[model samples]
Target: MDTQQNTALTRALAEVPGPLPTSGVIHITLPHTDRFTVVGNHLAQHPDLSCTAVGLAVRIQSLPQGAKVGIKALAARCKEGEKRIAAALRELEAHGYLRRVRDRLPSGRIITRTVFCNRPAALLHPRRPAEAPPQPAKPEPAPAPAPVPMQRPAPAPVCHPTAAPPAPEVPVAPVAPPALSAPLFVPRVPPPTAPKAPRRPLPQPGELTPELDRAATTFLSDLHRHAPQFTLSEDDVRRLVPGVAAWLERAVRPDSIRRTLTDDPPQPLKHPAKLLAHRLTELLPPVPPGVDALAALDRPRPRFTVTPFQTCEDCDRAFRSPTPGHCRDCRETRAAYAQAAA
Candidate 1:
């Protein structure tokens, strides 16, 4: 595997806590079940773990009884990183799947390594099971013999005369053939498309007089707020009244123009003038003035600063730091824990 994937696998394996062995015993978890979950999930994503793990298991199996294998060498042979292999071994140890052995070689040098050869048959499931032996058949007993019978000679027979034969009967007439059925014709139906509904009448241009225009604009603003689903376009406005677009331009200075032609207004301003501003900024030709123009200038860069913090897991509390890092509760808890463990 690549370095990154190997690192991830290593980290995942390290998350497991257990021991590895050499023969007759398979690595496994003890009372705790969570370790199994982490290992199982890790293996699920990278099946290579199985191959590498099994390879290490096999290598350990090959070693002389009680002989430990170097973690580095095992990892190299398995084409996995040392860290990942260590994680797997750690997980195994944590789960009580395997036991770690530390010793000095005959050279009087210290040996710090792991041996993962085998596990208890109960813990390690065989990938391929051994075939069962053929069963022998049972023999049947012999049957008893039967008794034979004898036959006797025949006596003399008498003869009889024959009578005249009757005339042959006439042949029966054949029945008529069955009537034919008529061919059926089914009408073909076309696939369904959009439904056809009556169209609503467009609002009249004369309807948008100065006074009515104010009312429609106010009503539309209220409608937009309460019923956001319903949106009125510039065409809807211009169609309702003549010169409404021009009136809007004078009433409110929109960012850019939309080349929409309407019956009432020769030139129609676009709906969502802000959206028009963004589009104008992107167009090849120079965009209109206002927000878009101001945005064209280069601005100052933004800076971000983060305050330091400390956390106390024993108390499950967090606090912002005024000076340097220090959590009194965490330190006290760790000290107590160390003393207790010692």
Candidate 2:
């Protein structure tokens, strides 16, 4: 009895070690409930991709449509440098997992659109998925035997003097024809390439007036206090001053410019400098010519004729005003706002 008990204990201890793999992986995965991304083995386990590229591919696949996957954006999120991230992206493009197309807007703005494929092989060859291990075939049951009709005893043969043998009958084909189905297809339209626009350099440091330079510098510096994401380094501030100067030179009020920039900012802004650059360029107002441009810069910008919805600071009441500030009653003690140029 003691020997039997010892034998059982030894067998159980040995079995515990047997279940453990000598090499390879052990997974403890759970069903994803939310905030999960589906990645295919093609991208996840590519033989050619480096560890960084494979990781980036997984991250890209998991991202929702329209999400930014640029090298700079990815570098910001991951520990990799911009050059490293850029190289990884190139590797992915070469392997057919990623495609970047430069597209142009009617407004003459160019944007690079990135397309990601979870399974590149399946896209190139539709039947490639058939290479997966086939499932075990289920056993088919034997068909039931056809029932036999009972044989009627033959009637006694009647003999006729002039009976003619029946003419040979021809075999007829089956009535129904085989069904045919059309093959499935997925159509992909390539984005149209836009002609490259000539690059325009920003106004040089020497061209901007000292006053305009000061205002532009202060404007960028103040953004950090109100909107932390807009914080700029000294070099970035210097680099971007020319953009802000362009706005100031056009008779734009510092207040309005600040409001325009700070309003409805993107969440988790990756590159504030780039964001400012785009807004400064695309939102640039038409440049008024010569004497009129100089005259416009001398005075406060004209107010809108139509009163828009506004919330007052003093009373916190919603009211219609051409600009943001205290309502009429709250601002009665202060000087009246400028009316439209007449």
Candidate 3:
């Protein structure tokens, strides 16, 4: 009856989704030794050990005795950040569950070895015997020596010499004083000064010469033909003349500027002057140093070949080949027709 009851309990446990389902599979069962039990029960509940710290400890224990461990490798294996793993290792060291010994080899190399412990270090090894107090060294006695005798010298006699007589002194004449004169007058000279250079007059607004006026008129006329809505007044032309002159100075053709402004603006422009100024500054062609210097010599000249005109099939109007069979207006009309049909 006991054997039958054991078989029935095993059958029920096999149906559960856990390790018991694969009990026959190859496994290394760790013995419930004192160190293992203490690590699972006591270290897991340690106040200083966080969940991450406990998990790291378990991972370290599962490894072989002398296997290498690094913060990066451990973090990758545990799917945690390096900083968190480092913090966990530091906590383990602080709580005595880990020890890191650093030593230098004779080759002048330093290395660190990490030792994982299931229990505190004090429990693993016996306390070292207390060291004895140091005592002072004894002094040695001095030895005696023999004494020596003293000696004396003799005295000398005194002598006398003959004396000489003194002579009389002679009289001298008195000296006279010289007369003083008045001081001489002198003139002071001033330093030479440099002449001031004349300043050139600043160009006034709308101050265009005949040639510049003609160029400005032609540019304005081309711009007006392309975008009739963007009309420039006399003052506007005056404000924009410098930018147009800059383009001309760079040897940019007026036709190129006109085509650029007209050919399919990226978006519907509300301000033409600002766009023109930006284009004139950014897209201005390079100017050679002298009239004899060709631009093509420095760099290849950009090809701007005009596309062959194609007649629209629907509107019967000549248009560029970008739309192929239909012009812009016809394409919009067809789109509207399709929308209506839909």
Candidate 4:
């Protein structure tokens, strides 16, 4: 009875026409009504984009506005490094899927504004005159139309099957179609730089003093505590030692350096080493002036006049003098009195 039931079930299964019909990737797609992103086929199935670039583009498209999509931010979120992410971004740019514009804020800060395009070719490519509408098919000539005896003046030599080509089965007519995560990474020729002046080489943190090295290393290693995103590797810490040492050389307090570096950092701090390097490069304070210069700046200025008003001792007259004394007239009067009495 079990065998009979198994046979019956197999028959039933074969008779039923259901979804399991192919040996390939199957889609169990559901209609997406809400919170769905529309991706263009050009980007989704671009023949030129690498797998990484395609995936990254999709991720970027699906991201909400104001989300941190910076190279560092994405690197932190995804299983990719800055270099890979950057290259992917470059691919996107080259294909017109991304644009990065440099905008100057009212505060004069230059910021990269990234724009993402679902269909970049539309904007980047010149408007192609609307493709001519396809027309109905017309019958083509037979590959080997033997000459009719009545029409032919003479019998022509027959061509080989290989020599005669068939008409195209169908005319192929395939129609073809940034908010910014970072500053333009477009490779640009660097402007001619002025000849750099020769000066004493800067002291490396390691070469300067063991104490400085120790201080820098300790600060970098412990940076993750204050800012979790700054969790750095041994190499990163080593790379950043020079920046911290620069702060030290300028006599900026270690605490001050930590505070400045850590203060209100961009959310999703992607690359701590790079962030530290930028701060070190751009925000460095001018070398703290020498003691003599500081003294000059700090010297006290008198609030009172150079010569103060003084009251005469004998005449009770006011006089301008450094020390308490009589005015000119009062002094003469006193001297006259003394001489007359003598």
Query: Where in model 2 is the C-alpha error above 4 Å?
Result: 1-18, 126-342
Arranged by lDDT, best first: 4, 2, 3, 1
TM-score of each: 0.19, 0.32, 0.27, 0.32
Clashes of 1: 29
Candidate 1 per-residue lDDT over residues 151-178, each given as its tens digit: 8666576576686798899898898655
Where is model 3 poorest over a 10-residue stretch in terms of lDDT? 182-191
Q: Is candidate 1 or candidate 3 better by TM-score?
A: 3
State, as a TM-score between 0 and 1, how close model 4 is to the true structure.
0.32
Clash count of each predicted structure: 29, 0, 0, 8
* Residue lDDT tens for model 4, 3-38: 999997777656655656668654445589899888
Please give, for residues 1-342, the per-residue lDDT of candidate 3 as tens digits. Answer: 999999977776666664653456544344575544335577777765799999888889878767767898897687889999999988877776777778899999998978776766345354456899998887876766655655645546656566556656666666554333321111122224656655323222244467766796678756776677556666666677766765555566788867765566546677776666556556656554774465547777698978889999987899888546888899899999999999
Task: Give the range of the ten consecutive residues with the poorest summed lDDT in model 4.
Answer: 178-187
TM-score of candidate 1 relative to the true fold:
0.19
Of candidate 1, the 10-residue stretch with the lowest lDDT total is 182-191
Error of 1 at 121 (Å): 6.4
